[model samples]
Target: MAPPQASSIPGRLLKALQSINSSAPRLIASPTAVGSNANPGASRRASVAIIIRLRPEDSPPGGNAASPTSSAAASASTSPFAQALPLPGSPTVAAAAAATSEVSASDKAAYPPAQKDVKQQLERFFEQDWVKRPGTTAEILFIKRATRATDKWSGHVAYPGGRHEPDDEDSRYTAMRETWEEVGLDLAEDDYLSVGALDDREITTSLGKRLLMILSPHVFLYTSPETPVPELQESEVASAHWIPIDLLTAPAARYDSVSVDISTRLAPKNAFARAALKLLVGGMQFKCILLPNEPIATGALPSPQAVVPNAPLKLWGLTLGMTLDLLSSMSLPTDAAASKGSTKSGDLSTYPHAVAALPQDKGALFAPSMASIFPRFSYPDINALIWIFGFRYRRTLKQSPTDSARVNWAGMSIGSYYAAVRRALVVAVVLRALTALGGLGWLGWTLRKRLQSRRTARALAL
Candidate 1:
């Protein structure tokens, strides 16, 4: 009789599934032969443990949220006790937790209440700066860690800004609203030179709170040439300070090596050190080492290779990453300009004696460089190169698709490597099964034991 036909949908499905399963590596043994392995009991136990770990624990009998674990585990999960717990996707949290569980274990310890009050207090403080002059420096308030509310990210410093309120008509309105709410500054449009929308980022507060702060930092220029007074807002903004541009530009003002050095002559050494240290630390630390002052003319702003206005200052974590991204962006050409110029090199080997046969000034063949495009651009090529090296590197400089073909080849290689590894694993399992079934070692051991006993008996008889 002919084999049964798989005409029905179920039968067809079964056949298809069998074919697919045959080609795939086996993950489970058939139930009928499950116990027919060298270590069936051990394997079964491992499988059961894996399944249990994957299942969500049943809720507690009470009205309260279901408890994942009971007894000591519940108490140990408290913020203070849980500080050392690993947070998902956190590179530092794991190492930090292991190094010092005491500081990170509990929710309260990891993010205390003090951190919460600072954001609220600082927000209120910046609201009072609205009527103030432009061109003056301002310190954006940040939350401290010890008094933070949640474990998500506690005790981190950040700008005081929130979602647009009903009264805010536009981004400018929202900026002012946040400024009023967070810091006591009441800023006006004229006070702000430019308002730019930066890349949106999600941030977690120290109190375990998550928020999407669309950073639209208003470049407020002090209109008042006179000394400006900062009004501190309650709960939101705790305090404010006027930071000088020179302080940021000076080599003596950074925790790391400065890009440029300021001319210091005829300044008092002790006074210069104190000022420089203050500029470097800026509430980051209690004290820092700094260079001594030469004179009033000695401490000048060091001219950097490139200086972009409103360049982001990276502090920590996501904020730091975002800040770096912004700084990097200052160097990248827009999509339009990136498309300019031919990437091809002319055949120079045919005319080795002629310099003209070499790769033409391809830059001129398309659009001029950003520096030449904007003659007013003050930065030199060296400074621009340093500032935007990352952007330049990331750029797809090739005009033709063939330049990126190597990436495709690399991807194929990776896939081949993965397939090879899978096949090797399957072969290893099959070899192990064959070795176990043959029992060659066990048979050899029995024969050797019998021979040794017989030899001992013969020796005694002799």
Candidate 2:
């Protein structure tokens, strides 16, 4: 009677255990954390950032700390698996050659100043290892711009970053500041963690003309359990999307070519513009990634006109290039041939039906005559000739030392004008040569006929 029943004690103990479990803090993995079943240092989540390094010559000093000579030496002392992996177009061979010729510290001190300078220059040239350029590693954020008549990039999907401001200390700050301003997501906040940066890419026109501005892509991680909802600044962003890292690998995501109208933007008379126009007018084919059901946080825009209700967002051009870089950095094979037997979950066939379908236009881009001539002859050859002679012609046309004073007839460079004239001259010369040959043949025929008639007359007189 004094002691409690055994069944009652067990129930009490179970209640106590439940209370303890409820009070305990749940352990959340860091964005960079690797799964227990995954290969060491391999990340299972798409939130992780991969820092891609460039060759020494191509990159600024201190970009990467590992020296090629030291790497080679370390590899020589270790097993085959420990040896540096051979990368496409890597400078390992050159590094090894330079390493072999390297002098000890004592030998360098003994050398004269002139000799030391020469050796240092030589070392600088050969010391850097050239590896196959690494792909981009960051899960970059892209923003769909609001449709505005004044904005050149209106309705285009682009990164959240913008031009550097005087208030920004550097490009990293510009990216972060822009992120906060446009998306209402403060990258500097506690929930977000800064990752490394990708190499700076030069911004260019759609036709491949270089621009003055350069872009630096930075990666970040969101540590919170819940996905942060982006508050879009309607003036800039129409909608913001968090594209899955694996979305690009989907089968249905592939679009061989999609037509984009860019004629209005390009100079119609420019040779480069002409070539691009020819390819794009009928719809230029491009490697594209489609995101149909990706999470999109809509902002202040008209209902029907805002976002494609349920259509897939097509990513192409520079955006597509950046996506490829991200995949390449992950060491994931991207080629159609290599991706076929892959064991990734990115196969769109396994996902729901695509809400938006890309137009199927896989037919030949060029006419039969144009297609046949393109391989053996094309605009590129003509452009090359213009480039070489155009400058000289421009110099000749200069009336004064100043470029403005120089005559720019027809709103084009003297090179272009001369190129057109040269082509006309060639055609004219060909026609004249043909006419002269025809006249000579007629005269010869007339003489031969006269001789035959005289021979017949002589025979009749006999």
Candidate 3:
């Protein structure tokens, strides 16, 4: 066969075989890099290298494959990488899928997420029991009418608050200021349990100016077996009550109502409280009560210019709304059976009775006396009365040009003082009116004088 002509074919094969055998047995062709000599199969595997690289585009794609000899250069020109990756059943694909699933499962279990906004944060805060609890103890305060021993609005539903002072720092201070001044309760620093603040309003006061009343209404509960006893201060408040928060918020219990001047209505706690009351009939959920509706400047009455007729007492306005809001916001379970089983009030008792059941450490539960916290009024009469001074000191005072001066100079403080002054002023005005009618005729003047004297006597007495 003349050397079989196979030598030509075998010559090239022999050279490749020599290269694989002589070298460290590279599994790759050309054998430019390190290879394994430890394994004899490495040489045997060298022949298969050509088969693995049969696709010229088997190399990675990129500028890094700029070299013409680089396998990636040829691979970059074609879609070889996609072809190399085995589908579904490949070990490499299976391992990667397993890893991804494991990671996803871990992440799903480890991290969730939440909501953060001012309104949302506040709403969340109000849902707490301490925030929601009907404050069993509360006080009401008002300034005494001029020359009167009693307050301008006696026996009225009111907030235990006063104007904000420099020390009060905020509206909470106003509430605390009035609380301290009106009642002798000494609430502690940590005693404050704030819910949410009500809207702000300009209050046209009977005492004076259009004061900016920034009311920070709060709900604080005091639980005890015994009723909460409030130390009364005759100067600031004649009385204090610890009524149920439920009652105050109850639509049925709301007794006072006028034409919807400048008030908002709070929805009734249930369908029952809402259907019964009429004056609280605005359909909204809040109402406004003016503290002393006299002129701001004159601090006197009978001036249309002084009355901001529709100006809501923003401070108390919001407070009232919040009080009702807090109560109605609670959602009792609709299923009677479910609610009965879950209900906790059955075993619960008042503060003293529940001492064993309640939390042990209730940091501070009382506020300071109003006299201790509130600044003394600047005027001599107001200041003297605030300090509980006797009439002797007031009797020594001099007269001024106005009738107010005469009343202030009189030995009177409290509700009786105002009554006396009001009677005297009304009598004088009526006497002038009678003179215009017929100059105080015997019958008219005698009857008027008797009535006037009786009213004056009543006003002067304590």
Better of 2 and 3 by lDDT: 2
Model 1 — TM-score against the truth? Answer: 0.28
* CA lDDT of each prediction against the hidden true structure: 0.27, 0.39, 0.27
Candidate 2 stretches with Cα past 4 Å from truth are: 1-141, 250-252, 268-283, 293-295, 302-308, 332-462
How far residue 123's Cα lies from its native spot in candidate 1, in Å, is: 31
lDDT of 2 at 225: 30
| Model 3 stretches astray by more than 4 angstroms | 1-155, 189-212, 223-226, 249-319, 331-462
Q: Which one wins by TM-score: 2 or 3? A: 2
Which structure among the candidates has the greatest lDDT? 2
TM-score: which candidate is best? Answer: 2
Error of 1 at 312 (Å): 18
**Model 1, runs deviating above 4 Å:** 1-146, 150-154, 202-215, 246-250, 253-314, 321-462
**lDDT score, residue 430, model 1?**
58
RMSD, each candidate, Å?
29.4, 25.0, 40.4
Tens digits of per-residue lDDT, candidate 1, 261-285, equal: 1112112366765555333222111
Error of 2 at 430 (Å): 15
